[model samples]
Target: MDATQPELKRALGLLSLTLYGLGTIIGAGIYVLVGAVADRSGMSAPLAFLLAGVLAAFTGLSYAELGQRLPEAAGAAAYAREGFKSHWMGRIAGFLTLAVAMVAAASVARGGAGYLLTMIDIPLPIASGGVIVLFTVLACWGVKESVYAAGAMTVIEVGGLLAVIVIGGPALADLGVRLPDIWPADLNGWGGVMGGAFLAFFAFAGFENIVNMAEETQDVGRTLPRAVVLSIIISAVLYMLVILIAVLSVAPDLLAQSDAPLCLVVDCEKSTMAFFAPVALIATLNGVLIEIVLMARVAYGMARRGWLPKLLSDVHAGRRTPLKATLAVGAIVFALTSFVEFQVLAKATSAMLLLVFLVVNLALIRLKQVDPAPHLAFRVPNWAPVAGAFSSILLLGAEVLA
Candidate 1:
């Protein structure tokens, strides 16, 4: 924590936190993972999404405990610093969290740009930059405005997914419901499934984002944990439902080939709802907007605490937003988008995310022993945190083994 800087305002309510969680959840994962999982699991792509959700839930419990204890910006960093009792561990955790944010912004920016091109005749790069610029400006404006925009975007994105479900409901009903062989009985056979799990982890990226709002949230101890766990559950269910309808409504092989799987679903089983593609695309664009703002805020928070360049700590006087940080984050994301291979970017995201979650879990265990917080708005059962931490470690090992 920067002793010199003024304390960040806590303006986020539970609803805002929920929106932040949801906005973070509905990003490139939904746009990209459907095909990747379909390819890996054949017809059981929905199961891959569910498996990823379960893995994320364990991490979520760990986060709920620590997020309640720490309720500070640089969420993972606070936990790591307090838990490990080491400055370096905190620094590494914060760095990895920022790394995930950068890649997330890049992926969402690229996805938003693609959506814009599909809706219009604009050049892809130019449209992508436009999306980045829009988000950068919003983030530089302030947290309150960004939260409002994020909340609205969450609704629109959820509406898009709901549209898909409503349209595909009849088809889903027609196909007898049964759990497929998604979670292989061998469990050891997940050697092949790890890649898809890594891909699906993208959906859970937004949960850590709540820590960025520590400065802006009201009653950080009470609300942060609620937001963390509830938002993850909400987003997970929504994502699973979207995947279920999307995979079952069409041939899994065909979905594996389609680039815009939801759009393809709409074009096929729900042609009447085809008009909503534009709406869904717009919602995705809004999600990118929220992501860019969050990326900037987290970077700003880290910098204020001396984790990054001090220059990033600058805030616009009128807007009270981290203008310099917003610009810097946008530039970094844009450069990555322009130069790096997407697959490498995605894998890097997965690896960094795993580390961040592991640190958060450790933070909870550490704080429980060192600085026990009481009467938190939320608390995980004692064993849940331990189980969650080990689960994260195992999943990370699996990812590495793959």
Candidate 2:
């Protein structure tokens, strides 16, 4: 290792990394997207989530294999460079990953502001701008601190979702919604479910961001793969449960109409679940924080490798964090939040990640063929990357056509 090269502190253990992954995975997506998916899939929203989870897992397995082989920040870009041996390809993949982070953070912040307005009377711009600034400072403060804070926020947000489940469970029996309705009927119904799954795919987007924190995590090879898979499974279960409760508690058409859909699930008649709104606000902020942390690491990794400006590689001597990259990411996120609407930004985020996932899966397949590591800590089946690449392309097409 070069002594002059900027280095991030390896302060994150397995627990912190797993919690961080869980926090990122269960963040703004479930809080904000359940209603939209319900609109498309009707009573079968849980099926959409389940199918989306399967799609996410396929690509996730590829990432798990790559993480073991090359545990580094700017994960997808690093994989592309090693697999394809093309600087331009690596650069594009890296920047695209960063773009996804920025757009996702901005979308979450915008949604957070909407949640905030339900409790307080403030301008959306002011609220959203305040979220970006606050999270940026937290991100620059220290890696461990930022992740721990996010973990706490994750607990609160998860509790909120659980509360909805418990509250809505009894209603399911009363509504007489048959269990079979959770699955769509025929080819036409399956098409609608698949479209909903494509939209629901956004809910599973944050798991890949975990790989970008490779440099900061303890025991990267041993820990990253486990954390990635565990976080996705946990988030998938929670999303399916929440979606089930949502469809059971309210009419799909009505759930689709509101910005804060979870609140409707908690109390559709009053629509004033005091705890749900604040919890959602926390979830959105947590999403922004995690995205900021991931983007900074990506920028730092790219800069350290000369793919980006060297200045961005600078680590704060005292904090041992990438302050420059953090601020740069913050600026971009703020600009996006200020200019773009939530749905547009969300779709852009999903679309960009689908492309990145395709490249990453292809990279993994290429690496397996050209540079087989017999002693990798983790390895997926030969067909895993192929399936991952195929699913990514299929989902990308579905998203575009939808």
* Candidate whose TM-score is highest: 2
Could you tell me how far off, in angstroms, the CA of residue 12 lies in candidate 2 after the best superposition? 1.0
lDDT of 1 by residue, 1-402 (tens): 444555555678999888888888876678656766777665566666777788888878777777666666667777788888888998898888878888877766555544455556876667667777777778777788888888887788788778777877776664465444444555554554665767788767788777678778887877888888888888888888778777777776777776566777777335566566566666656656766777777777678678889988876666767788888878877676665644566667777788788778777776777655666766676677676677667767877776
Candidate 2 local Cα displacement, residue 62, angstroms: 1.1
Go through the candidates in order and give each one's C-alpha lDDT: 0.73, 0.85
Worst 10 residues of 1 by lDDT: 174-183
Question: Worst ten-residue run, lDDT, model 2?
Answer: 265-274
C-alpha displacement of 54 in model 1, angstroms?
A: 1.4
Per-residue lDDT value at 285 in model 1? 65
